[model samples]
Target: MTHTENTRVAVNGYGVIGKRVAAAVAAQDDMTLAGVADVATDWRVAVARAKGYPLFGATLEHVRAMTEAGLDPAGSLDDLLGAADVVVDCTPKKVAAGNVERYRERGIKFIVQGGEKHAVTGHSFTAENNYDTALGRQSTRVVSCNTTSTVRTLSALKQAGLLKKARGVLIRRATDPWESHLGGIMNTLVPEADIPSHQGPDAQTVDPELDVVTMAVKAPETLSHLHYWTVQLTREASKDEVLGALRASSRIAFIRMADGLVALNSVKELMADLGRPHDNLYEVAVWEDMLTVQGDEAFYAYMVDNQAIVIPETIDAIRALTEIEADGATSIEKTNEALGITGRLVPEPVAA
Candidate 1:
């Protein structure tokens, strides 16, 4: 295999996000999926193997277990890292932080998911908000799914000089759909213990100047997250102006309930109908018709595909860390093109 102009990317987990990241990385013209490493021999990891990603064990014990299970892993995690230019740590919460020392010891550039604290990388990333800060940097933490959508939407308004302060309520999914059978809430809601829940602060890590506060509660379903925001604009603005401001960012897509995307599940179904890989909704699905403006206040709601939203940001972060693309817009445009992320999902509005 020749490594002339591509960045070799090793993914540290093959779970929900890892599997998606692996696929996205393999789709890029300037990046290569070196392999995926995980301790499991279940269907998830098996799928990666089926897709022809080189397998690796996170530990010697894992290697033995995988071998016993007939999953032929190439080697340990270190072997995977040694073969790549950069690694994306998609391990579960707190686990990726523990792997940081290993990555640094090998002088490998790495990116961690939002599960870990900002202190883990000392710099948090959302492609549009902070790409240059991560340029040529050894490491960065891609903020979680919720934070990614929040930053993308708010940054759009901020850039247009329409943002003053935002107060939002997030109805979060209980768990990834794949893991719902394991354990999740039933017929009830679980609210985050604190007001201005951690998501608000997490978004701040990506853009500190944005005046935003959030409250979140977990719902029973796993389709996706719903965020309703009441934003105080810098001045009174019309719906079209606000929509245009949001439309400026390529990652924010407008979906209309009038087009039969009345709910999150409907939107997910649309993704499958559109032939999106893994039925992924890479853009923040803001309801175009549902948004309203009253004087200087604007209200809107959007759906966040928890499993898929962060995938693009992670892709952009890969380019930023590797310096494969110097301009953030170029990296975003390339990623969006490869992933088929047009600002509109349904080309023609469906008649209700």
Candidate 2:
């Protein structure tokens, strides 16, 4: 809480998300990068060492060598768990359930990656919406990239009382076969029909009253994921109102309102021009030409490079949970309220 007192933070599982989180934490004045936990000899461990971040949960000999080399290294993950005030679980979803319980037992607070299926009581955070839900909470989950983008845009519409029901279709590119163990090599445009992608459901978790439908397809390209969305509104809202609302939302960085047409490539170019290096979690690029509204039927479309959108939101969530002053909670809270989902409570079921 004081300048001299650093928020000791550890990142579990050093992958893309873990790497980004570490960098963000390092950049913060109120927090210190305590260490990273991953299997010994993993690329993440190597990266942590290279970045001068302490290595944890790695081989004892390797840790000692790194420590002797003038790097801070913890002998094992247990040391990190004991020393850190906050542990961010960036491990894959399949492994998160077990790890979350362990951190809970250790009496350490956590920020969980949203892809995991574990049941946690913490708030679901996105910078544009539900930041307060995470701020001051002992545990919080950063919603998946797709969910963050969907909810931020829709929450704005919902707040304006314009949204009635929402339906979405996603076309996602697979992580390069080398990047993922899942065999995506030579596989192009594989559709996941009838299976509900987690994003829609996660959005509903934030606002249960939201009726949502979602579909997905996976491509071989590892670049970005695209989403096509439709919303039925209570009344016919003008296109200007929709565009104006989107522009005003802080979580939304790049939005173009061009005579009711939105395009993905334009948004992508805009981000490039803006010098946004990471698009997955930090930025949500929107095309004005892709948006269409006619009568009560409104259609919206956009593409989000997952890595840019998710990473920044993840960083913001960590800062909020740790009560870091510079994380800009006020801006996040104000944007969330403007999006119409502020203080919207999840309903409790009645006994029959």
Candidate 3:
């Protein structure tokens, strides 16, 4: 169905993902930022107000507190929902789960971040993997950053008919950059006790047929999560063939160590140089030069921008749940173009 008017989108948190979702919704020609709801009266909420996004409190008490703090919320969370056709709940882990009933009661389609379990939504979303399933649905959980990256790259290969089974190792960021000062691991690498960390099973929520397992450890840094994948191909495939498969998805951007992008920080620096908002890298930054293919195995690595990778997917999810756009590919293209997602971080060199 074609939407004549913009989708009214309200963001329920003004934190990392919520703020980005608000900006993305405002950026879309087919959507409008109805308002933002949050309990905080600090700098984050201040920034949300400064951006001119209508502000609402998460509760009546929170609204009173905001007024006391001079933040002047327009109303309560209920008011925000009344103005929005859909709401993206980017509240911290477990918090969004509590808001599910509120959203359902309002009959507003809602989206929860990956921190919430699949049972909360009964459907997990990654635009490339399951956009159609989410269309006109009441709610969906956009999988975690690691799972989002995993699905984007692996689904590319699976769609290309090169994947048989896959195993991955994840190096996770100990904490978010903003919260690093509060507390985080130092001089330590904490391994996840479970062999297949939650991300693997979570990825399966989007595609149950995937034969995938993952192990992970928390790293000291807060920049991004790095993943090393080892995949058994359906048959012997050449390096060129594997690269071609990965290149098919616009959400997977090719980065190279040869161009001085030797580490995660370097890729983040490149994003800043490219003038991305908050230096966000929405695509899975895969090392094209490092990807290798053996007889029936393909080994590669990529970086997941935990803070930013899922922003585009959330935008597409808003489109899907609202039925603003019927075709998945069309919504994807619109989102990519609006967010400036190219498949490569740098332009390919012209041959002499």
Q: How displaced is residue 159 in candidate 3, in Å?
A: 0.6
Q: Best by lDDT, which number?
A: 1
Clashes of each: 0, 21, 0
Worst 10 residues of 3 by lDDT: 341-350
Stronger candidate by TM-score (2 vs 3): 3
| Evaluation by lDDT, superior candidate among 2 and 3 | 3
lDDT tens readout by residue for model 3, 181-211: 9878999999999989999998899999899
lDDT of 1: 0.94
Candidate 3 wrongly placed segments (more than 4 Å): 347-352
What shift in Å separates residue 182 of candidate 3 from its native position after superposition? 1.6
lDDT of 2 by residue, 1-352 (tens): 5536878888888876787677776766556888887765645566678878877754576566656555566567778888788888887776766777788788788988778642674467777666666667778777777887788788878887788888899877677223766756454577785657667888776666778878888866666778888888889877777776666655554444552224444455545554443332254555565678888767877767676566666666666777664446554453233222222111237689
Query: Could you arrange the candidates by lDDT from highest to lowest?
Result: 1, 3, 2
lDDT of each: 0.94, 0.68, 0.93
When superposed on Cα atoms, how far off is each prediction in RMSD? 2.1, 9.2, 1.6
The full ranking of all candidates by TM-score, starting with the best, is 3, 1, 2
Worst 10 residues of 1 by lDDT: 1-10
